[model samples]
Target chain A: MRRSRKKQVIPGFGISMGVTLTLLSLIVLIPMASLVINASSMGFSTFWETVTDKRVLAGYYVSLLCALTAAVVNAVFGVILAWVLVRYDFPFKRFLDGLIELPFALPTAVAGIALTNLYSDKGMLGHFLGQLGIKVAYTRIGIIIAMVFIGIPFVVRTIQPVLEDMDSQYEEAADVLGAGRARIFFRIIFPEIRPALLTGFGLALARALGEYGSVVFIAGNMPFKTEIAPLLIMGKLEQFDYHGANAIALVMLAFAFLILFAINSLQIYYNKFTKQ
Target chain B: MKRKNLITLGIVTTLLAGLLTGCAGKAAEDADGKAAKAIEITNVSYDPTRELYEAYNVEFAKYWKEKTDQEVTVTQSHGGSGKQARSVIEGNEADVVTLALGYDITAIEEAGLIEAGWQSEFGNNSAPYTSTIVFLVRKGNPKQLTDWDDLVAGGVGIITPNPKTSGGARWNYLAAWAYADKAFGHDQDQILEFMKKLYQNVLVLDSGARGATTTFVENGQGDVLLAWENEAYLSMKEYPGEYEIVTPGISILAEPPVAIVDSVVDDRGTREVATAYLEYLYSDVGQRIAGENYYRPSNKTIAEEFKDVFNLELELATIDDELFGGWDKAQAAHFDDGGTFDRIYDGETQE
Candidate 1:
């Protein structure tokens, strides 16, 4: 195996690795390191105080709860959308596939303003909902709606390729074994797409956690209610409270890192178990 | 193969270096050409001043040309006042800053960009024009929100921006505070209660003044909007009879100040032009343009001329009054983290 790797097509492994590490450090690691350094420069007590302040804690709660809800929603719908696009031959399939990526292409602010306009109390759909005594905008529901809008593309794009690459032989064999439709999907197809779904779910979760633009517009930003962590950081910055902002941001960074790390470990463990 | 790779790397580096130098050379040439024919200055301002400055910039350029025999071009950058100040501090190369409040410019000054006593540099605390807070209600005064006390009355939904993020919203908060101070007879506890009730009625606390306007006027969510007098007028102009501006019995005198960023002007060799640009805002034409844009002119004569246009009868509170002290004290006491505003929401949420 070692000899085969050495004789592979791409040469200059050392040079390529050096370039990759340099670019990664320059583009990603350096800025993140500065954030950590800035946060740490404030004493631990101050950091703790800033992060644990009731308003900031409320912001974190709002952000985490809304992001989790949005990610879960995207996960369920995204899988179905990806499966349909990959498995079926339908009219406007290509157009629908393109449409799924609109959230990714449109500026988040534009998406936010457009969503706010459509969901405000006086808006087209909102008027009916208002008459029904349901308030969507300026509430937690609005925040989740904005997050889901920005997150759907992540889940769908991640799952679509895996679905397309999935082989049909497993399902056909399961069918030949007299398995029911639901059983075939649950036992054969689901297991194959589980890793992709998890990856998509993690990506969407991270994206929604940091979402600011669209969510802020629809959030109404009521403290202890609709204020998200990013807005808290912004509010701190607006007051020229740099140390406080960095502290809150550091806590959020740690949270996002832990979530992604746990998801990746779960995928690895699942992959190992399945292979065994 | 190694030799070929090295050759490719050498070519790429050479191209990148050549491209960078080529761009730098072009920029230098362009600067020299512009220096010979015209002087350019960038005026960094806050959001609501976009239209005001757009008109004023053209007027200033013409004035500069007539007086100095040199063509001048003015560039404008606008955003949330604090964000714009941070941009300048982070080296945005602003020659002049006409921000929404003195505190924002003070933030820039503390960053060592502008000289101290910048407020005293121009007339009226360096504020070319002034505006006050008022209510923008739906047509026919549906809620009849005539005063600040009525805002806290039952069934009246209010829309205002968060003071922490918006310079204009700080004025709005202070204006309400002033009203409460008078209404509650200088009793701190009663004023706090009044403020809490007023905020409780706020359906949407947007991040900026314009956003509050959108929440009130466009979204149709709130019964009344606490907005700048100029902003209220601009909304009426845009919507045409769909909204009405009600001058509250008492409000804050919102003085959006301007100043030349000393370090930047000295560095860029634009002190003279920048100073002239700001000073020109005090000129007669400048005052008229400000009044026409719905901002109450700081020039007493011009303000008198526009008396019919603006409600000059109401009592206006100044930030330097005994109640608030100054911007620094006001900010620390009311809008800072864990301050009165946050405490109000904190207590409400706990209940």
Candidate 2:
């Protein structure tokens, strides 16, 4: 008998791969390469001067701090939100689920203005906060809040499906074995969901890194204080310093890539650890 | 099932093709040809000129039609002056740029979009109208704000855009500097200290003039808003009794300049019409419109006609005076990177 051929369930990997490669190159690789090339065209000294300037450095610090803080906050709260939606049923359960995606759907500028209004000294929320002597709008806290608003969906959406698909049998077994709630969560559920949490955190962090419109309104944009990296890049461009803008943008892109790489490695390590 | 999937795929592909071609055609029509029945020119301007330009576009279109009998359309794009200048430098096709400050137009000239010495091409150094920085306080003049001093006084919040980004804010910054410089008899250290205090009291720094206004009026974020004179007037007009325009004893003469983008108009064969459109800004009708809109008209007669509206008698400092020198020197000493602004904010004196 002739050698039997095994038919594939999925069709045309070659065509699909070609399409994926073309789209990625067109959308991502080309633009990133152009940015790097443009940044490098400015001599090394100029690039150094642009990125290492104190104001630019401060901007980078603010952006990284707020993004990371917001991402971590999202990771914790997002998991709780996902868990609640997945484990509980309530009136407007579907509505709350739908509302979780509002940030993704809303224009960032509108969200920013709305948030600024809500947290301003005279705003409904801000009025009570003012009585406590804590200023939220126009401070670093405001930047983090805005980032959180923009980034919440990234974490929730990332981990929601994982939580839903997870079987409750492991938790049941743990409980039957006289395991405490904390031990059950940490020993069983935590290991399984850690990879998804890391992915969500990374996504939220990345989204916050490039955020602009909302932050500007609430940032108060004090140079070397509340200004973020993207605003600095925009400031350079506004001053007609294209090379300088590119230099700063290239630095941000590099830093973000490095961060995302580390997060992915952590995710892979956890995934492997859980598999065994 | 196979036939249904094929039909669905066919319809989707056709829709995508149709959408793509439609966009391509729409873009092509923008710069398709020169003098194709109707000519369109883009005026990239700074914030606060929106209403002025909207009125001017209608007037200019009428004049262009009455003179050349060719249908003409005027489109406007407005933002922070420096930002608008950057867009033009990045190859935005603005036939004319009417910005809040001349330095922005100078930047475009430096980029070689317009010929050198564009200031001499039109009257008043190519500035058709002038404005000043004034205080827009909530009704009853809360914080007892009178001049630049009160802005920096204890427990008062001032709302002004960041000078690094806003042209109007630069005017606002310099006006404060001029006030303190004069008060202290040009003591640089004292002036720097005063600026630091003033900025410390700035509750929020918006990126543009309009954004600053919104922060003050809508968000209720500041006590006194350092604003363009026209903006202050417009706010009082829009919300009667909610705000008051307080003219300071001395204010800087903010000459918002207008210029033709020579390269753009030349390439589009619109040089003649574009030039006329900007020159129309200095005409009697244009001057009257400018005057009525709270801008100090270049024409003395027209400006006097609207004296009740503009409060034109306020002593105003010109940039050409010995104090600020000019835009070039001022831009370097103050607004440039690592300049006075950065030093003041960094709490470092430039020794």
Give the candidate number with the greatest TM-score: 1
Sliding window of 10 residues with minimal summed lDDT for model 1 chain B: B1-10
List, residue by residue over B170-199, the lDDT tens digit for candidate 2: 999999888988889999999999999888
Best by lDDT: 1
lDDT of 2 by residue, A227-258 (tens): 99999887776666789889999999998899
Q: Write the per-residue lDDT of candidate 1 for residues B16-46, one digit (tens) a residue.
A: 6798899999998999888988899999999
TM-score against native, each model = 0.96, 0.91
Over 4 Å off, model 1 = A1-9, B1-25, B347-351
TM-score of chain B of each: 0.94, 0.90
Each model's DockQ?
A: 0.43, 0.31
Model 1 per-residue lDDT tens digits across residues A1-276: 466556667876545655555557667999899999999899999989999988888999999999999999999999999989999999999999999989989999888878888899899877789899998999899999999999998899988988888889988998999999999989998888899899999999999999998888999999999999999999999999899999999899998999999999999999999999
Q: Which ten residues in a row have the lowest lDDT in candidate 1 chain A?
A: A14-23
